[model samples]
Target: MEILEIENLAKHYEKFDLKDVSFKIRPGKIVGFIGRNGAGKTTTLKCMYNLVSPTGGKILYGGEEALKIEKRFKQEVGILFGESNYYPSQTVKNLTAVTKMFYDDWSEDLYRHYLQDFGIDENKQIKALSTGMRVKYGLALALSRGAKILLLDEPTSGLDPVSRDELLDIFIDLVGDKEHAIFFSTHVISDLEKCADDIVYIKNGEIIVNEDVTDFEASYLPRPPRQIRRYPSKRQAH
Candidate 1:
């Protein structure tokens, strides 16, 4: 079954208009949302969670309107708009305390595990982290919420090659469970080659290509990986 469906999503700005944007994200897949800058990728991501209201169309999760089940949708579907650094002066520990208050399913064990795994120093303020660390920290918060689907926008933006590779590994590991999935936007096609299973290419606010990465590369994207590594179907039926 498809995990999420975006039907005829459209949004309008004075200068830019997103038209007929549509896609489906299936469980057990990494769907890479690819586009050039100012192609409405971030705007489309925001519309999914109602951060920005869509001009038309539906965001459906489990066959129900996502906004109708707003609280549950927010809880079960994690979204990170780029690397988050909302309160630059806030210590990681203090910020985490406040964040935990919002999620009923927040798992302390998982949170601690990610902190250790990412080597984030909780005592340090947000501004102290390097670009890579900040991204990892945002990931830790998103992953610890136990969300089955993660929506990430430009997650690999400022990382060095090594850091980007490590982040890609984490994305693969997270979606190893068939019940979990990721939909991330990136202009960095090389990163998608390493992990993504499907490609959703948007151009000028419209979906131009939606297919397996291999085909996408053969038909369009020039930089294809040596191979794609997909780790899916590692879970029991619910």
Candidate 2:
């Protein structure tokens, strides 16, 4: 069954527009949303999470209109953006404390586990942490929520190769239960190639392709060599 469905989704701004975007993410699948900068990938993810309103189209989560769903529905959705906007004065522990009030499923043990696994200092203030550390904390919070669907936007963008690989492994572990699904957006093709089961490519606010990664690679090949004109052989010309 489809875990998330975006139908004819569109969002408009003064200078940009997300035009007629549509796609489906099935349960237990990791789907990669690939696009260059300003390709509406973030906009689409925001719409799915109800962070921004869509000008047109509908987003359904497990048969319920996502926009109309109750707060409880949101409890099952976890989102991580490229940059975190947490309060700089707060430490990771403090942030987790505050988040616990909002999410009944929040697990303190798991939160601490992730902090250690990601090599993040729980007592350090957000402002003191590096950008990659902030991203790690954001992911920790998301995973601790016990959510079934993870919506990540460029989650590993600024990290080094080791950090990126570690984050990728964390995601893999998150979905090991086979009950969760992940929809992640990124420009790093190699990262997607490593973890994605399906891929959706967006260009200029439109979906260029959506298919299984293997299928895309199989169908995607270098263009054939073109015929080249050569000077007629001297013998043939004679």
Candidate 3:
């Protein structure tokens, strides 16, 4: 079943537009939104997360219109953007305290575990952290919120190769339950190859391809035609 569905979604701006984009993310699957920079990937993601109002079309979460959902229901959705959104003066512990009040199911243990795993210093101010460390902290908070749907925008863009791989593995582990789904947008094709079950390719404010990666790969493989022998000739003669 689909955890999220976007149909005929359109978002317009002065310079660019996301035109008639449509796709679905199934439960337990990682759907990669792939495109080059300025290709409308972020616009689509923003529409999905309700951060930007769309000019047209419908967005459904688990069969209900997303716009009509209750705040409690919307709270189950988590978004990690390309840049850190935390306050510069606040430490990780301080931020988590504020987040816990907003997320009904926030788990401090899980947050702490992720902080340790990601090598984030909980006591350091957000401004003092490196770009990659800030990204890691943002991810740790997003995942620890007990969100069923994660909307991640260019999450691995600034990380080193090893950190990127580790983050990908963490995503894989998070989806092992089959109750969660992730809609992640990234220009990094290699990261998509590692974690994406389905791919949605966008270009010039339009969706070009929405397909299962395995199926697309299979279609690219060579196939041989079967040959007919004497039996076919005999039938023709009869």
Candidate 4:
């Protein structure tokens, strides 16, 4: 069964309109949500998470309307917009202590494993950790809360190359279980090329393409110029 499906999703504003955006997120696959900045990527995500009301369309989780089961849907879905910069003064442990209270499935063991694996110090203040570590910490919280689907917006937007690569590696490992799915939105095509299985491309508030990553790349990759065979000029040919 599909974990999440967005059908004919639409959102409108005075200046920008998102129209007919549709896609599905399945288990164990990373679907790269690709679009340029201001191409409605964040707006679409906001609508899905109920941060913004969609002018049209519906979202489904496991074949049920999300609005009908909003609480359960929210619990199963983890959304991280950039990183955990919300409580810069608080220690990781303290922030997590509060975050865990919202989820019934929160697992301390899983949280500790992710903290160690990501080299995050729970005692460190949120501001003391680097940007990359902050994102990792967010992931730890989400996974420990038993999120089956993660919708991350620009998760690696401002990281250094090494940090970006490390995050991508973590994404790959997270899906290895074939039970988790990631719908990652970004303007960074190279990041998708590294870890995305499929892509849902958007432009000007509309979906442009939805296909396997390889197919998307092959369709857009620059092709070599055609060779032109030229016979000798007519006057000299004879």
Evaluate all candidate structures by whole-model CA lDDT and list the values in order: 0.91, 0.85, 0.86, 0.90
Best by lDDT: 1
In Å, residue 28's CA in model 4 sits off its true spot by 1.6
In candidate 1, list every pair of residues with a backbone clash: none
lDDT of 4 by residue, 103-197 (tens): 99899999998888788988999999988788778878877888889999988876778878887887898898999999999878889989999
Query: For residue 20, what is the lDDT in candidate 4?
Result: 95
TM-score of each: 0.90, 0.89, 0.88, 0.88
Cα deviation at 155, candidate 2, in Å, is 0.6
Task: Give the alpha carbon lDDT tens digit for every residue of 201-220 in model 3.
Answer: 89999998899987755663
Looking at candidate 1, what is the lDDT of residue 68? 99
Compute the lDDT of residue 30 as modeled in candidate 2: 85
**What's the residue-level lDDT of 125 in candidate 2?**
88
Error of 1 at 173 (Å): 1.4
Mind giving the per-residue lDDT tens digits that candidate 1 earns over 1-238? 7779999999989999999888999998999999999988999999998899999999999999999998999898999977778798999999999998999889899989989988999999999998778888998999898898999999988777887888899889988988899999998878889999999999999999999999988887675576866666658432
lDDT of 1: 0.91
Off by over 4 Å in 2: 221-238
**Candidate 3 — which pairs collide?**
none
